[model samples]
Target: MGKRLAIAGVTGAVGQEFLQILDQRDFAFDSIKMLASKRSAGKKVTFKGKEYTIEELTEDSFGDVDIALFSCGGSRTKEFGPAAVKAGAVVVDNSSAYRMDPEVPLVVPEINAEAMKQHKGIIANPNCSTIIAIVPVWPLHKANPVKRMVVSTYQAASGAGMAAMRELEQQARQVLNGEEVTCDALKYQLAFNCYNHDSQTAPNGYNAEEMKMVNETRKIFDCPDIGISATCVRIPTLRAHCESINLEFESPITPDEVRELLSTAPGVTVMDDPENNRHPMPTDASGKDDVFVGRIRQDESVPDNCGINIWVAGDQIRKGAALNAVQIAEKLL
Candidate 1:
């Protein structure tokens, strides 16, 4: 029998993407419940030629659900996740609510699907940037044992949600038409301008977004000692995120070897072609499932050839969030 699926936050960007991914992947579901906040209840959404009325999400919403794909914000998840679990549904949450909890499994299915066995009714999705950066890194790490990683993320407006994406589009037109730029969805102007992530700055000077990449990488890799430093910035792109990653391995690993390792890695697509200067870009990665990887080269700063640099891009809303959660739900079946 097919499982009963519930999509929480159905009106939001990631929520809508969840619906698209489920169809694209042909996920088996006997029934699907479209849930959202009270403000969005009763709205109609059509999926696979069937129309589903958005229902108000509450503690009672999960009684018949077998798997709940939660793209709701952290607060909503905190209020309702346990209720869903208590009602006999497994939650694959995209919020940060349960990510660092020692008992909850922080999963990237491509890297560690086995960890799902430890879930106490809920599986936490890693941060978008972390997901994008680590998909291609895991294969190399398994072969050479990455000792450290230095990452700089060029995130898209999609990370901040649909409002931010609309703001970017509006700002772009206003700028080109000589209208005053407005800043509401984001603290600063995001059209043709990049800025540090708007997440709160921690005492250590790293913002929450950067720290999420640092902390979540260690947790997902199951190596509490792995050294990771990240600098996160929001770029003007509408979707997909790009990262420049420098890796230092325990033993010498060449760029070619890294390429060979990632070539067959699940969820990775290598696009390195220096002759044509073709490489991974957000434009190519938007709405794509696989992370595009390229610009493979040796990092000259580190001696013994133990260091290498690569660039990657992936859709933040697809593989990074909705698709990842849905993939975890697939394992449950």
Candidate 2:
């Protein structure tokens, strides 16, 4: 029999992708419950040719649910997660609420499906940038133990949410028409501009988004000692995120060897062809399930062929958040 499922925050961007991914993957579910905040309670959403009314997420929402995919922000997860667990439903939360919890497993199914086996009723999904970065990094790590990694990210407005995406479009049009740009979803104009990600600056001079890459990467890799540093920026792309990774391995590693490792890695695709200026880009990765990888070359600054640089891109909403949460649910089945 198919499992009974509940999707929290059904009115948000990731929630919408959750619906699309479920339909695309044909996830077996006997029934689904659409849930949202009180303001969006009566909204209508279509899934698998059937209409589902968005119901207010309350303490009583998970009575018959076997699994719940949560895309609501951290606050909601903190408020309602325990209730869902008490009601006997496993939760795959796509928020920062329970991610660092010692007992909760932070999972990216492609990299660590076994972590989900230890879930105590709730499992946390890693941050979007971490997910896109780690998918390709894990294979290389397995091949040659990585000593350190430095990453710079070009994140899309979609990572902020739907409001930011709509603002990007409006700002671009306003700029083309030579009008003053008004900022709502962000503090500055995103059209014809780029800025550091706005995910709350921390005391250590790193923003929350950048720190997520550092902390979550370690937790997911189960290598707390691995050295990692990240600089995250928000670009004007509508969807998909890109990253440039510099890896230093314990032993000498070559570009050709790294390519061979990633070629067969799950959820990764190579697009390296510098001769023709062909490589992974946000335009190509949008709406795709695989993380596109390219620009595999040696980092000349480091000696002994120990450093390799790579460029990669992936759909943040699909692989980063919603699809990852859904994949964890699939493992439960």
Candidate 3:
């Protein structure tokens, strides 16, 4: 028999993607439960030719579940994750709530599957950009330690949620139709425009999204002294996220070496063809599983060929969020 599984917040964007990915990968589950908010209860959802009624997620929801996948929100996770663990369910949370907690392991199956072996019932999926950034970086770090990293992200509206994605689509049509564009999911209009991530700004002048990258990287690598900085921006794209990264290694490294290393790296695909103007883009990455990497070149600022620049893109909803959470659940199996 397969493990009994439950997906909290099944009505949300990431929750829906979790179901899709589970089916796509044919993850075995003897029973699956769909859970949502009170408003979404009683809704019927079909999976694998059977319909399951969505239920309100209460403390009792995880009683018989062997594994629970959470993507509802941090507040819900804080309130109910312990309940799930108490009920003997291993939780794979996709929120930031427990990621920084020393007790919880922030895992990317491809990068740190072994971390899950130490979990005390809860495991965290890293932030989407952090996941996308680390998949390609970890391999190179293993080869040549990365001393410092600077990243700038072009995140899509979907990172905020499905509502944000719908808002962007509506705003774009309104802009072209000469009607007023309304904003709800995001602070500013996200149609045909871009802005810094709307997450609260810290006293350090970095937004919450930017700091997640800095802090999570150190924790995942177990290297507190590694220097890292990030600038996260919300671009007017529907899905997928792209990042420009500059890495300063402990020693000199070449673009060719980086390409060769990433080529064989699991969950990474190289699309560097500068002469033909080919490179990884959100359009090509949307709905894809692998993080697409390209635009490899030497950063001339650092001497001794110690710096290299690369661009990476991945489906914010897949490898970044839902798919990663499911992969963690797979490890438990």
Candidate 4:
């Protein structure tokens, strides 16, 4: 009720999620502006049960906005984030543009909420893949300094954008209609299929998403020397992402100790029981705020009992993007 806010890329997936979280939390805001690309301009969007017309994002869109959540893309954030700051609005950008900038804070509230206070007008939410990995890993990293990690992420098609989600849905429909599967939003048919390839394949084989998990994890944990390896795969799921994480620490870390530490950790739901065939699943985590972690056990591959294997999941659009950005904005206030 005191401040005005604007959701850039309001028509986009992350932007819509931001609006939903704000409404769900009953955030007190006097005014809400929804900004989107010109193509989506003049479209109608409803916030807090009120109909509002979406405006095309321009250099002047941030006027009188107290906070602007940017999720359009990195290029858009890089182009307009500073302008929003100049217009007197704090920007919580859900992109990689300013994440590695030494001046801009890349925050995951549980791991680095205090960093929000040091923002240079813009705070960055970590990458979706990184966000999911860190939720369950941070508490462990805090208790024991992680020496290294090797992770493989099974991401959702929705990570690409709403188009990818639609493509998967439409493709499945096509298959159901007895037609050939389409592969427009992805490199391969994502309808009831899985690809063990990176989000953006590199010459060396690792994808951009794979690198984000490695780089962003080190930055969030403040452990640049930690040896991190990652392989990111895209799955047919609509929303949530799953990660198989193997962490190695300086000392021998135990599964029991992890269970104790994570049992009450903030925003974490520990659901492990390999023998019972219980573990974190995307279906279970979808539309949820907390990150679900399970399959906790020691890894025999890493020596000294210093390694543990686990699986984790969370809604990439929520915790991995919108929710985290909103949480940071809340911290700013």
Candidate 5:
């Protein structure tokens, strides 16, 4: 029999993606519970041609749930995750609450499905940029061990949630109409411009988003010693995240060999067509399941052909958060 599933934060962006991906993948579930905050409660959502009412989330919400997919914020996850677990539900959490916990497995199913076996009750999904970067990187790492990675991300407004997406649209229209743009969802205007990620800056100068890439990449790859430097920026796109990744391998590996390796990698699609300059872009990756990889070339700065540069794009809400959590839930089944 299919498991009983509950979707927390059902009104949020990632929560909506969970419904779409589950239906797209035909995930077997006997029943589903739609949960949201008190303000979102009593709302209606349609799934698989049926409508369901959004119930207010409480500690008791998971009593009948076999698996709970949580996309609520870290605070909510911390407040409710253990309740779900104690009530006999496995939580595939998309927040950072339990990610760095030594007990919880930080999983990118494409990279480490086996790690799911180590979950005490919650399986932590890695950050969006980390997921998009490493899905394509893992295959290459298996071929030639990656010693270091320098990543620059062009993240979409969708990464900040639905309000930020609307803010981008509103700001763009306001700018074109010669009106004063108001900022609420994000810290600044995001139309026709870019800025460093809005996440708080740490004492070391890395923003929270950038640091997530550094720390989560190591945890997911199980290579704590691997060097990672990331500069994350918020672009004006609606969805999808793009990254420029410079990889230094332990030994020499050519761009052609990297392409060949990624071509067959699961959850990856090679889009390296330089002659016509058709490469991975946010527009191409939006709403897509596979992470698109392209621009495979040698990083001339590193010696002995040890460095390779590549570009990648993927739907952050899909693969990076909701879909990844669901994939871990699938492995449980």
Candidate 6:
């Protein structure tokens, strides 16, 4: 018999991606369990031509389960994640609930698969932006440490949830029809616009998502003293999210060397050629799993060839959330 796996929040966007990735990756599993909140219980989800019924999450949910992939949210993970771990199940949690815990390994497999080996039971998937950023940056850091970075993110509505995607479509039609634009999934209309902050309200003036990038990157990169600042904005797109990154290395670097590092980095596609007006964009990356990097150049304003500017894009729902969670499961297996 193969491993038995349980998925919490099995009906949500990330859950659906988990199913897709598992099927695509051909992971071996003897049985699959679907779990959700009581409000979503009794629903049927189809995967690999088999229908699985979702049950409400409970303390005994991990019985006989070897792995649990959690995306229900932070609160649920906080309340139930430990219980699952205590029940002899390894948890690959995709929430803010445990990523920062020193005891929990905040992992991005490409960047730090070794961290997974250190897992006592729970391994946290870093924030989507953090995961994507580190995928390209970690490889560079291996050659030399990064001392400072300033990033501005153009995130997608899907990061907020499925409702945000729907809102973007509906609101776009309303705008086309000249109807009054109403905000629901996000505080402001998400279509054809951008914001400097992540959520509508940011406690202490730091958007929650921005704070995640600044903080999570530090932990995943294992650099506590690195100077990092970020601004995460919700763009109108429905799937892929992008970021404009400016990084300063601890030592001098050349564009050629930077290109060499990223060109061959696993799970990263370096598509830079500014003369050809080529760069990674959300539309080109909406469905891709690899983090696309382009627009590579030395930031002339910042000292040395050490300063670099690049664009990054990835399927926020896939690598950002579900795909990453599933990858951890595959590693555990």
For each candidate in turn, the TM-score is: 0.99, 0.99, 0.99, 0.96, 0.99, 0.96
lDDT of 3 by residue, 198-299 (tens): 998999899999999999999898888889999999999988999999999999999999999999999999999999999999999999999999999999
Residues 211-311 of candidate 5 have per-residue lDDT tens digits of 99988888888889999999999999998999999999999999889988998899999998899999999989989989999999999999999999999
Q: Give the per-residue Cα lDDT of candidate 2 at 22.
A: 96
Minimal lDDT window, size 10, model 4: 196-205
Q: Lowest lDDT 10-mer window, candidate 5?
A: 316-325
Mark the regions of model 3 whose C-alpha exceeds 4 Å error after superposition: none
Could you tell me the lDDT of residue 302 within candidate 3? 92
Question: Candidate 5: misplaced stretches above 4 Å?
Answer: none
- State in Å the error of residue 312, model 2: 0.5
Give lDDT: candidate 6, residue 264: 91
1 or 2: which has the higher lDDT?
1
Pairs clashing in candidate 1?
none
1-333 per-residue lDDT for model 6 (tens digits) = 579999998888898888989899898999889999999889898999999888999988998889999998999999999899999999999999888889999988888778898898899998887777778888888898988889888888888888888889998998999998888877787777776554534657777787788888888878888888888877888888888889899888877888999989988999887888988888888767899998888888887668988789988999899988888888887
Model 1 TM? 0.99
Q: How do the candidates rank by lDDT, highest first?
A: 1, 3, 2, 5, 4, 6
**Model 4, residue 39: displacement in angstroms?**
1.1
- How would you encode candidate 2's per-residue C-alpha lDDT over 166-269 as one tens digit per residue? 99999999999999999998778999999998878999999999889989989999999999989999999988999999999999999999999999999999
Error of 1 at 305 (Å): 0.5
